[model samples]
Target: MADTQTYKFNVGMTCGGCSNAVNRALTKLDGVSKVDISLETQIVEVQATIPQADVLEAIKKTGKPVTPL
Candidate 1:
């Protein structure tokens, strides 16, 4: 089995809908196992086996700017 990895991103999530958007986008990717977003902190924590670039692209699809942290 592939080792799961966690990545953190500073995103612009202001509410539950924004968080849910991020979750939905990332969860659709094949290797993504989990997605956690904190609207208060504007942080997105993703646990997956996919490449970081792929994850970043998924987040960008939400129309939110994301910075790796």
Candidate 2:
């Protein structure tokens, strides 16, 4: 089995819907094992076997700006 990685990002999320969208987007991606999002801080932490770039791409699909942390 592949080792899981944790990727953290600062996303431009202003509300619950935005956070939910990001959560859904990441959760749908293969290899993604977990997703934790904070709307107030606009922080997202994803645990997966995928690369950080792939995680970034998934979050970007939500149309939200993302900065790696």
Candidate 3:
């Protein structure tokens, strides 16, 4: 099995809807195993076997600016 990696991202989420959208987009990815989002902090943490680029792209699809941390 592929090693799981933890990726943190700075997502510009102003509301619950924004965070939820990011969460849904990330969770739908095949290699993503878990997702944790904090709207207050505007951060999203993802546990996945996929590449970090893939995770970043997933979050981007939500139409929010994402900065990988």
> Each candidate: RMSD to true structure?
0.8, 0.5, 0.5
Q: Provide the lowest-lDDT 10-residue window in model 1.
A: 12-21
Please identify which of the two predictions, 1 or 2, would achieve the higher TM-score against the true structure.
2
User: What TM-score, computed on C-alpha atoms, does each candidate reach?
Assistant: 0.93, 0.97, 0.97
Write the number of the candidate with greater lDDT, choosing between 1 and 3: 3
Candidate 3 TM-score, C-alpha based: 0.97
Per-residue lDDT of model 3, residues 6-30, tens digit only: 9999999998889989988988899
Clashing pairs in 3: none
* Model 3 misplaced regions, further than 4 Å: none
Model 2 residue 36 CA deviation in Å: 0.5
Pairs that collide in candidate 1 are none
Candidate 1, residue 58: how far the Cα is off, in Å: 0.2
Model 1, global lDDT? 0.92
List per-prediction Cα lDDT, in the order shown.
Answer: 0.92, 0.93, 0.93
Better of 2 and 3 by TM-score: 3
